[model samples]
Target: MQIVDRLMTPSPDDADARRCPHDGTTLVSRISPLRSAVRRCPACLRSWSDVTTSATADPPARFHSFRLDVRPEPAAPSAAPPAPELSVVLPALNEAAALPLLISDIETALAGESYELVLVDDGSDDATWAVIRAVLAERPQWQAVRLSRRFGHQAALLAGLAAARGRAIISMDADGQHPTEQLPEMVRRWREGARVVQAVRASDARGGMLKALTSRGFYRAFSRLCEAPMRSGAADFRLLDRTVVETVLQASRTTPFLRGLIPWLGYETHHLTYEPRSRIAGRTKYSLRRMARLATDGMVSFSVAPLRLATLVGAAVGALALADLIYIVAVALWDGRAVPGWASTVGLVALLGAVQLFSIGLLGEYVGRTYLALLNRPPYVVAERIGDSSGPPPAGERRA
Candidate 1:
């Protein structure tokens, strides 16, 4: 669909030639200033812009009072332009049932602008690919990337974001839990010049007591531990402008904590509150084990607090050991009796061993991440391409 039909209003400079962010192509103006202006990108899709500023320049006073319209000239017609609206990237794993509704909600939210939907299916052994194909068939603006295997949700999201062509990109869950209705507010904030719009979960009651509590606790601790500015209840359902997306893409790390990565990139940001909804269909992709692993990953990926704590612990243990040694020597020299309990020695030995092991494990986690980085493995490999067949299909597109 053409983008102008979706605009609630138009901008005053709507008739002026605008450059596409994805490609340096100039766009042709389709409508007048009163209505929405359709600027078809030379490389991608048509986009609509609101008419806030006037296309006609103010008349010069004094001698010019006699009046001339002094209206700006319209842009020349050009090749198909790149899409100008936001790119919505939804990472899916066995989420066939929820995909349709999620897409519908996003379409409704982005009613007035042109957008591209990139659905990255992360190795689902179900009808997820079928659903994606169906959506793309119905909507030419959509794209699908299927991975060869389950590269995990974060990797899938990264793939989709990498392929996004919008000036702004948004990432959210495919389970319909992330409310698409909040998108307009995000876009409004973007229009107000915020580069990043983070969605902070107002409440996660649908996630159940255990999961919700764990999530809250993790975020609370993480905020205190990480140097990066991460909100306590913020999540992956976020909108990023072109600058933020480009910066993030340049961060070439195989193991990525995207929620933390954006803040580290340092951009003007805004926050929106949305109650996270329960999954409409399919089981929860993030199991407890997966959550724990992700938490650990976030901790190590974003903070050095663990390492510092380890050093402090070691120092404290050494001081205690020295004090104990001094106490033993004083007892032998003055009291003439060694205050020794076999049980106490055994407990102390076990405690020290456990502490040593725990410290080693924490250090090893960081080392393991470093090792993975050194290996330089591709985050995900695409197995097939379904609709366009231009390159290898996404990984999950492969037939079993």
Candidate 2:
């Protein structure tokens, strides 16, 4: 029997420096080998010989053959079908008036391909659900899910995406601010192998100066904090490939900022600029308080900037306290002045009050989140599901 030694190459591309099984020494070739194939290590000299033809021969002579074929067969092609046409998910709260126009625009956007429109009603006190049902009745292409109570805008959007059947999904505002005309461009980007296609609203002709300025500032601050490739003027109106959608969905947390989450999930993304149109109907759902809360969520979810800021503040306070102690010591030793009782009392009170407030605020932020989690409160609840209840209920509907 012939003995053969095998060596493992460092890389598929590298042919030299193969490990020798006999002496455990690396074998280096003067010239590059034809292919980096697994061969017998020279050190151990361990080998296997063919004895089929020499079965009757006793103590057959050993022959070394290094020309044996070790190539592997090529893999078979994938049998999976092409991705679905498009899935449009709209999150609406008290947007009954704008639903018709939004639906119409979506239908126009998906003219060439088979598409499904999912409307998530975020527990609107108005006739939003009624309007959604009416639209579905008139347009069979549309489907909807109603939350038991208001689950906030982001949660509703998540619900819609979870229920989407299309291989590519588009998320837009129910306020009709997002331009449906941009759909063709977004779809083109998707076809060109972009996993995430963002609709960046470069101009908001309908918004006032104050709103525009605030938005620009927020985006700027957010971009700086996030590591993802975030650009200014990007909005939630965007399209995602099936893989990206699945990836984002898998990262399901109670506080979901999809716009930020898209970048966190590494994928090829494309951005298209468009002018945000005016709302077709209904007042804006996002009040100042809600916007602040959303901003806080986005900041905390994507970055530790706040925590760092808190650290800086604590350090600054410590330094100030040290300075105050030094000042009091100087007055006692050198100034030969009596320590003013009111001044010390006032300074201590203010300093302690500021510290207490800051600490409470920081603790409240973390405590509030923990409370929500402990309660096991769902992000949203589905009161009724239209079209295919056999399938999974809308996002945030499943009880943990």
Candidate 3:
């Protein structure tokens, strides 16, 4: 791996020194978990690697060969330490092809840093669990959580965050929408006293004309109708302070629209606008139907405006009826006959009927959601968790 800092070059004289070129501190070298020539210092958070290219590289970037010491190490003493400085919570679903590579990118970005990686497998039908196991086998710094079933993205993310053991927790996508390179900026902002660092999308780079128009309308309507003001292009890729994380877990609603819910926390939020990259693997887990459901969740979870909308429609219909009555009275006094037309009457009845049905449906949606929430169901159920050799899984967990 190419390092920007003045890393020590391999030479007979320098090799004997075995010290960090930037600092006079002694450098400890060992075969990395990935069996790479990745020389790093835990104290300094500085690293560089010597790698041999293979078919894994597309069209061969370079070619060489090297060796790694793969001898089994001795057992460790039984002791536990403090939590990591940062924790990244990745909610994965059918992202086996992209998880390992994303893990690599995250490692590279946080090279030598004291951080934990929490990968949550949100009930993928594919070999995602196998990939998670393989990644855990490669490194003890990573933790993987698997749910019993698909509990949707927000729930999966909450599960990961609840399991996270970091001072500063980050939530991102496993399919590569949230870039790993900007992690430093997020940390910097967090250290600057912002409890939340929101990675706002620069643009909705996908969707057709109709989709775009509908999305715009949805946000506009949501902002005006709902008590919570959702930022346009706000994304779920974000960092939450440990206090906020704990607070969220304590609040523990059965359903949470995290994108809107995070903002509702009223924390000191810092905005970091970035253009999202396309996934390096399969299609998005969120289909159009799922998107609509998410939108509905956001709308209903934050406000009772849908119910108010029914009231508004009822009032507007009453106003129209009053206007019609006045017109009929005036027409009878002027010509001894009301304005002739069954057509107008049929049209008005149809319009009123449709509006009333739609209003009832909207009201029913809120009631139905409230009913489900009242049931007090668990947001998610954990199937298993791997990695974190330091200790057993948290309370009420199943081992795999």
TM-scores, all models, native as reference:
0.72, 0.71, 0.74
Backbone collision tally, model 1? 32
Candidate 2, run of 10 with poorest lDDT: 60-69
What tens-digit string does per-residue lDDT give for candidate 2 at 299-398?
7777767667777887788778778767876787787685567556666678767976887797678777778878876666787777633445555554
Q: Model 2, stretches more than 4 Å misplaced? A: 1-84, 204-206, 321-339, 389-400
lDDT of each: 0.76, 0.73, 0.77
lDDT of 2: 0.73
Worst 10 residues of 1 by lDDT: 60-69
Best by lDDT: 3
**Model 1, 139: alpha-carbon shift in Å?**
1.8
Counting clashing residue pairs in each candidate, in order, gives: 32, 10, 0
In candidate 3, the residue pairs with backbone N, CA or C atoms under 3 Å apart (3 or more residues apart, or in different chains) clash, namely: none
Writing each residue's lDDT as its tens digit, candidate 3 over 1-400 gives: 3233223233333333255566554333432222346755533666655432344543221112222323344577876666899999999999989988898889898887789989898899999999888878877767888899999999999988888989999899998878888898999999999999988777775756666676777877877877556677776789999999998998867858887777777888999988788898998777789889889888888888778777888888878876776776677778766556753586578768877898878978878888998899889988898866346755677765
Query: 338, model 2: CA deviation in Å?
Result: 9.6
Best by TM-score: 3
Model 2: which residue pairs collide? Answer: 4-46, 4-47, 5-40, 5-41, 6-40, 6-41, 21-44, 22-43, 22-44, 23-43
Tens-place lDDT per residue, model 1, 1-400, is 2222222222334445455576543333443434445444333665735333345743222111121113345676885556657789899999988988888888888988878888898999999998888888887656788888999888898888877888999899999988888998998899899999999988777778888889888877777888677886788999999888888878856858887888777898999998888788978878889989899888998888999988888778767766776676677779976656653475468657767987999999989988999999888887754433234544444522
Q: Assess candidate 3 and give its lDDT.
A: 0.77
Rank candidates, TM-score, best first. 3, 1, 2
